[model samples]
Target chain A: MLNIGGLNQGVVIDHIKAGGAMKIYEYLNLEKQDCSVAIIKNAKSSKMGKKDIIKIEGPITVDLDMLGVLDPDLTLDIIEDGKITAKRNPRLPAQVTGIIRCKNPRCITSTEQELPHRFRLTNKEKGLYRCIYCEQAYKR
Target chain B: MKHVISPLDLSMEELDKVLSLAESILQDPEKYSECCHGKKLATLFYEPSTRTRLSFEAAMLNLGGSVLGFSSADSSSAAKGESVADTIRVVSSYADICAMRHPKEGAPYVASIHSGIPVINAGDGGHNHPTQTLTDLFTIKTLKGRLDHLTIGFCGDLKFGRTVHSLINAMVRYPGSRFILISPDELRIPTYLREEVLEAGNIPYQESKVLEDVMPKLDILYMTRVQKERFFNEEDYIRLKDSFILDAAKMQCAGKDMLVLHPLPRVNEIATEVDDDPRAVYFRQAQLGVYVRMALIMTLLGISAG
Candidate 1:
């Protein structure tokens, strides 16, 4: 079994749905950061059956609002002096801009390359999003 | 800075105000002829829509207001690669208000954000056409006499018809606006609308494959065209074709007072034989579009008839 070191002072993005760490890593642009990052995929979990975890070395600041859009069940644990300090469950945002592209063919964002693709949370319980331009549903 | 991007943009009160103003304008056109004399209306159409463009122009002219702006993207700087935001910002300074029709959905929304003047969504792709909705409501109020406690039967292509969806959304807010959706199985109203809108709102509705089955139950029969490609099988198309077309025979099933409407440039969804029926009001509906649009422009421009 391959092993990775625990974070001394950073964040442990826990309970990410299995196979979702890489997407979060890419979304956060972790490769561009100076700090070290370790991804644990298919980690044993009683609750999720299997979950992916991200342990970041050293303190890092990234807006977690977008992560809610990816996986609403995502949990964030802040590490300080090698001890867990705070935990957060980032929920879906009311409005998200430029994170997801509007794929509707008739959407203005499709032709207007400069327009920021904006979405509004029309149904929170269903985690449904609609394009501000076309009201087309966001498809995963 | 107000923009009418969707019918939902107007509150119930505001909608009543606009409809009331339209009724008044219809009752006495000469009294409100100069309501917008010093104002100007810009028709910024990114696509060619002669009917909607002329209706808007006619509305402004009816108000004694001058009209300007392009009828197509090729005639404007959009051909030179100018953005909607940029064009609207410039046009905003040139006109007091503007009605926009764009092939891309929400182009008017983009323009509205950068515009200094009120923007009316003439039509936006297959997304929204608020003025058409306003006109429908105005027609209902002026001719049928009320907006509530009525049965509206939507026929033909309910799936791709933007007007049907918008009118449903607008009417559902009223006290007893139920729907009798008539379309082929392939072109029924989308699930989200059927489940989320109608079912969720607890608005009573029934779906049927045949138009005549629901004709007698309707107070307003709204019709749209059905493309041939939408059928699942050729034989079913042959069998069910006449069921969707409103002919004199189908009109027989309708009530004597029931009104028939269509967003025109209509193909054969409505038989020309039925056009002479006293209840056939689609052409009059288009004419009311001008009055409704005039009222919309005035309401948005804050130019009261008083």
Candidate 2:
């Protein structure tokens, strides 16, 4: 059994798809933060069979919606006074701005550095986001 | 108010309006001559397209609008490595509307984002050609007198033919529009189109390798060239190059009133002998390209069809 201390006042990101925590970690730039952060990779989970979790030791604003874009299975727990005060499961956003880059080489966003990489949720059932300018579908 | 970057951009209602305007223009060309008189159209073509460029120029001139911009990237600032965004930014200032054709898939879309004026995608690699789709819609509505309840046959190069894909995307919106997609096995329509566009919409469609077998049932026979340039493998190109040729013998099986249309500049895919056939309207289809473009340009410029 792996033992870790509870966060006094911070966020605990849970239920990440196995092996997806590092990407989310890199995306959030959590490594550069001044507070203590621990990443539990390949943690045993009854629901997911295997999952990853991240515990941040101090209160810091994170764009949870971006985590949803990266991995919709992720759940966030806001800890206060050593208690899980708020639990949140981020839904796929309707519109995401300047997060995931359009992968299509021909997409205008590739050449135009000044343009924001904007995508709109086109197919909710399939979790598809299409680039606003190029209309290239990105499946999550 | 709208930039036509793809066929999907136009709603069914908007498509009908453009088609009707095209018909009215076709009937009395003199009435709509001065509709775009004071307007300027910028044709920013990054690739060499004789027919599309000339047709656009003719359409603007016929509507009494002047055209500006280069015929090729070599002649334009694009040769100097100017991005599509910068080119459009500069051109939009001088022109009321711009029509751009590029080798890249979403070049016009990028231009549309940056330009102050409306941007029309003339052709974008294998991705889209909304104006060509508009021309096809106009041709179908004029010849068939209806947009619905028609069995349209798409023959040859279904996989890479952007015109075929665009036309199918537009026509499937109309009620009772069935598609008979005929192509060689190697050149069959892409699975995305089959599953997403046809199957997802619940639009009835049938695929076959033999064009003759499907000819009698078709109200419209749209032939496309098997573009050698699109194929990376020379052997595959040679094998499928003459797969679905539209000769007079093939036309014998087609309906007398069945309209045969092609986005022109044909090679050997369509035999020259078939050109004399009354059903052969590919030339007229090319001519309708002008009217459709005129309608599109006027509509994009907010000029009422008076």
Question: In model 1, where do residues sit more than 4 Å from their true spots?
Answer: A1-5, A42-51, A80-88, B231-239
Candidate 2 residue-wise lDDT, A1-140, digit = tens: 79798888989999999998998888888889777899999999999999999988885766676778777778989899999899988778899997788888876567667778888888666667888876778754
Winner by TM-score: 1
- Roughly what TM-score does model 2 have, to 2 decimal places? 0.89
Each candidate's number of clashing pairs is: 0, 0
Q: What is the C-alpha RMSD of each candidate to the true structure, in Å?
A: 2.2, 2.7
RMSD of 1: 2.2
Over B1-306, each residue of candidate 2 has an lDDT whose tens digit, in order, gives 589999888887888888888888999999999988888999999999989998999999999999998989899998887888898889978999988999877788888878999999999877789989998888888888998999999998888888998899889888999999988776789887898889999999999888889899999999998777767789978876665889999899998889999998788899999999999999999999899999999888888867
Candidate 1 lDDT over B129-220, as tens digits, reads 99999989988888888999999999989999999999999999899898999998888999998888999999999989878778889999
Per-prediction fnat? 0.91, 0.55
Q: What is the interface RMSD of candidate 1, in Å?
A: 0.6
What shift in Å separates residue B103 of candidate 2 from its native position after superposition? 2.6
Candidate 2 chain B: worst 10 consecutive residues by lDDT? B236-245
lDDT score for candidate 1 against the true structure:
0.90
